[model samples]
Target: MRIRKDYMGFAFLLFLAAANHWLLIPGQVLAEGSETFYPYLLNTALVILLPCYAWEIWRSRGRNDAPLFWEPGLADLGRILCLLGGIWLWADAMKHLGFILPTAFFLALCGWLYGEKSVRKLALLALVSPFVLYALFTMLGAALPQGGIEIWLSPLLVR
Candidate 1:
């Protein structure tokens, strides 16, 4: 039974869920007195989905018969480079600039690529999303990134 690429994604994700549950269950949850069935839940997910994915992939393998590889064009390379540049810029901005700056910058870059034309609208989104997200999560409850970037932005964010 040959495996298809799409089903491969399912398999890998199921593997990840199973792996994490096994590791975290004994390490984090077991130490406490909680009697949660997180491990059983993960095991059920694995047992149910993995065989189904494998069966589907096997059935579809010869039926689909798609091309083995579609080589990346120059535009694909350029887009990847642009994404890399954005990540590099984000890392630098996190250190020197506030989270608001790099985040908005990334959002603006992505939003523009997604075909936003109105400068005013883009600017509003670029600027407002971070605050909205911060407020929505911070006020309503969610964790925010506070990595080494925190040290660099401390003076600006703190004051």
Candidate 2:
């Protein structure tokens, strides 16, 4: 009766997702109307699927051969910290800078950090990805975050 180390983090995430689905989502009003329909469906799927995933992980826990992958070195810790900081900053910025600019900047930074050295490719991704995502969600009738910058630049960017 031994538990594999790598399985714990995934198990914890599954538990959290399921708990959030069952405990928190029910409290939130998700009627058969408005934009909440998608969230409701997603939550339903997660609530149904997460337990099965957890059970599978538990049943098929394998030996940790790549033991070093779990343990973070100094460089890995620094990169993780940078990513966390970037996420925090992005969340903060989204209130003032809006969704597109901050998201694009964050994605570009992430791409650069993850070894995307081609400036043209990174620039293309940074410029196009946000607009495409915004359009996709907007087409689905989802209201995206519109902040000061986006409002000011709407004439140039938004239709």
Candidate 3:
């Protein structure tokens, strides 16, 4: 049977959730009844994202709206190439520039890719997105993903 793409994504997400929980099982609870916060947080995030995904799967089960997966035809490989190349460059530059600059560029470029064409909108997105991340990490103590950006940016942004 040809499986629906949404099902495949859901399965992949479930597998990741399982893997995350398995990896953290030994750490979250101690034999002496102490608890580690890191694993608990990780497992919580994994579990949390699943329901949103499940809700999407339920909502989209019957509708033929836009394509679930963007299949860009033959010449569409160019976008893939650009995407990978940009990611590579972003990784290489992370140590020097930090997350904010590169992430802004990446976000704006992606918006452009999806046909967004307003300079004001792009500027706003590129600026506001990073601050939103910083706020989330600072206020909520959320574990934000980083490559090497923190090495340079942290000293300037945080005490």
Candidate 4:
């Protein structure tokens, strides 16, 4: 039987998952109780789900009626690359400019790039989402990289 072209992407992701499970996560020394829980849970889920996904894909391989992969046009490829670059830039900018501003700008830019025509909705989403995420992260006890806005606003939030 011929291997499906879609399997290539799945293989790559499976390899990454394996590497993450074996090489990376094992090296991190966790704290006492709950800190180790998520990694173990993720590993278990990956172990179970990946094989199920592979099985489903294998079972579906006989059906030639539907296309397995969508061939993206050049414009789609360019937009995907731009989105990736934007994510990298946003991550870097968050270190220096803080989470809110960079996240807001990235959200707006992504919305515009992906063909959201309503300027007011885009503006509102761009403005509101970052703060909401920041608050969520803060409440969850995840320490985020801080800059001017975070520095100022953190005092007011008071844990």
Candidate 5:
């Protein structure tokens, strides 16, 4: 009997879920609080959801006959490569430039690459999102890498 392509993908996801619970989460030395809660919750959710996904895949196996992966055209491939390169540059830039600037720049570049033509909207998104994220993560007790701007702003942002 031939196994469906969707089943293979499901199996890969199942393996990742198992790895997350058994291999990844076990190694983390979590503090006494909700830090441990999220990972276990994620694992539990995956345990519940993967079966449902598998069932859906099995139930609709006959209806779908798509290939294992879609082939992207040259333009699509170029866009994907540019996005990846942008991500790499963003990460490197973050060390020197700080979270907000690099993130804003990356967001703007991504927006342009992904066909967001409105400069005002892109600027708003690029500028506002990093600050929002920085504030959110700060409130959540996550330590992000800091540069001059972050160092200057930390007094106000961090409690």
Candidate 6:
């Protein structure tokens, strides 16, 4: 069977997922109950899903009769650059602004850049989602990186 580029990429990911499930995830669990459960559950799901992905990729091999694709156009390149720039900005801002503010801004900026013009919905998502994620991760005992904003808010957050 001839191995196409798409097949090679899918196989690489499948191998990676399986390896992480078997090797990395088992050592990373620090707690015996909830902390252990999520990682194992997710890794098991990925391990199961990856085999199905591999099978589908194998089954569909060489089905695309299209010739080798041309290089992406300048517009496509510009959008890719814009996405990278946005991500870089988000990371830089997060160092000082913390996860919540930068993530909200990043989400709103991404929505706008991708042509989603619903201001109300974007605003709601921008305002609410980050706080929810922060709370969820805190509840799950994940140590979020603290920035200036988080440092300031830590006193209020302490129970």
Please tell me which predicted candidate would have the highest lDDT against the true structure: 5
Q: Which pairs clash inside model 6?
A: none
Full-model lDDT for every candidate: 0.63, 0.69, 0.67, 0.76, 0.78, 0.70
In candidate 6, what are the lDDT values of residues 1-159, reduced to their tens digit? 343555556667777777666765554344223355556675678777876877776677567762243355677568778988988998788767778889889889878776889999899989888878777666656545567766775556555
Better of 1 and 3 by lDDT: 3
Ten consecutive residues with minimal summed lDDT in candidate 1?
Answer: 137-146
Ranking by lDDT: 5, 4, 6, 2, 3, 1
Better of 2 and 3 by TM-score: 2
Q: Could you tell me the TM-score of candidate 5?
A: 0.61
For model 1, how does the per-residue alpha-carbon lDDT over 60-87 read when each residue is reduced to its tens digit? 6666473243355677568769877997
TM-score order, best first, reads 5, 4, 2, 3, 6, 1
After TM-score superposition, the amount by which residue 98's alpha carbon in candidate 1 deviates from its true location, in angstroms, is 2.0
Per-prediction CA RMSD (Å): 9.3, 5.9, 6.6, 5.7, 6.2, 6.8
Q: How do all models score by TM-score? A: 0.44, 0.60, 0.59, 0.61, 0.61, 0.56
Clash counts per candidate, in order, are 0, 0, 0, 0, 0, 0
Q: How close is candidate 3 to the true structure, as a TM-score?
A: 0.59
Taking the tens digit of each residue's C-alpha lDDT, what string does model 5 give over 1-159? 345567767887899888878776665424322355556776899889988987887677556554354455789779989999998999799878888899999999999998999999999999899999888766666556688878898889766
Point out where model 4 deviates above 4 Å: 1-69
Residue runs of model 5 more than 4 Å from their true location after superposition: 1-71
